[model samples]
Target: MPIAATPLRVLQVTDLHLKTQPGSRVWGVDVDAGLSAVLARIRERHPVVDFILVTGDLVGDEPDAYERVRQALEPLGAPVHCLPGNHDFPAALGQRLRDGLVRWQRHVIVGNWQFVLLDSSFPGTPSGHLAPSELGLLDTALAMHPELHAMVCLHHNPIPTDTPWLDTMTVGNGEALFAVLDRYPQVRAVVWGHIHAEFSARRGDIHLLATPATCVQFKPGTAEPQVDELPPGYRWFELHPDGRLETGVERVEPARMPASARRAPT
Candidate 1:
């Protein structure tokens, strides 16, 4: 197999919690303003991105927000992949995003890497689970792409965050998900969003990453929904053809704020 000529850089932005209009607040943070700033920072910091993975919580249960999401994100000029979060209106989101700018894709193969997007969301709840079909899809995708390094993306954290309250909302079938992944050595990483903070763990060679939300971040290791002082942020991953990975989290600095918090038309 030919090695990729260049490393693949992916941007992961999550827990947008967008409202139907701009300047709306979630946990006291302007999410619309937050997302826009994160995107602008992404553009300025990393001019070239291979693909973007939004790990759920795209909206605050508003289907109307998906259109605004498309508009806010389209300027990045890269293929965007979305997964549903517990707060999303899945049906309306699918209908509204059927056209162009942003998209909902499950599996993608790029630059010797297989990117698998999972739907761990369960309607009307904050917990997550993988239906039998989704598990099968993962198995099949890995079987088909044994030649490519695999990175799994989903909405819920699959491992314990050591905080009792947040751990209750972890993927209900995380053990099952890991069972499938353990069978495939090509799987290198699993990433997600929802806890609204940064977390990293490792099991041998596999990396487990939980990114901070684009809006208000939760106080890490807290027992409840306490917002933290961390600025709005996004995660970047550089996947080398040799299966080595480099990633980091970046937040829009208050000094170099990308956009004003003033209301913009949704």
Candidate 2:
């Protein structure tokens, strides 16, 4: 692959967990407030973004809240691509988030990169499972775009976070996912949300990354769900045309979290 003059700059915001109500709380964190803070930080730090990738959980279980999500994201003035999380209603997302900057796009091609967003949200459960259709999508995308660097995006962590409680809900057939990617050398990274903490590892040459949620930070390596005092955050990626990439995470400043959300349950 030939390197382009400029790398594609992208922002990844995930697990928003927004609600229809103005001030909604999830696990003691005010989701709406957190999202607002995160977006503000993004606008301040990254003024020019090629596009935004929202991994999942755009809204809390409320189907009508997709409208709220669209309203919130449209002001950013950049194309927004999203996929559903376990807490989202897929049908509602497609129906309500069809216009403007927000869209439920499964595959996107930009510069020398191809982003394949998979839906791992299974009906009636928190766990994730990639149906054969999703795997086929991945396979087809990789086969069709052999020259472009590929990044696989989804809502659930395909690999374990080492947090036992969270691992139970990981992609049920992660081996199958890797099986497809292993065949393609152009695959650069596998990124996801839902663990609510930052995770980075390497499988062969592909980067395996799990980003922190925009609403809350979950304590990793815990036996059960626990909230951390770390502020809300998002991931940034600079994908080069030569198949090399640079990425990192940035959190909100001054730790504006409420006291109630700063501690783990006793």
RMSD of each: 4.2, 2.7
Candidate 2 lDDT, 63-116, residue by residue in tens: 889988888898988999999999899998988887668999999988889999
Ten-residue region with minimum lDDT total, candidate 2: 257-266
TM-score of 1: 0.93
Per-residue error for 202 in candidate 2, Å, reads: 0.5
State every prediction's TM-score relative to the real structure: 0.93, 0.95
Question: Which consecutive 10 residues in model 1 have the weakest lDDT in total?
Answer: 257-266
Best by lDDT: 2
Best by TM-score: 2
Error of 2 at 39 (Å): 0.7
Q: What TM-score does candidate 2 get on C-alpha atoms?
A: 0.95
* Model 1 lDDT per residue over 94-144, tens place: 787765758877888987999999899887778999999889999999999
Off by over 4 Å in 2: 1-4, 254-266
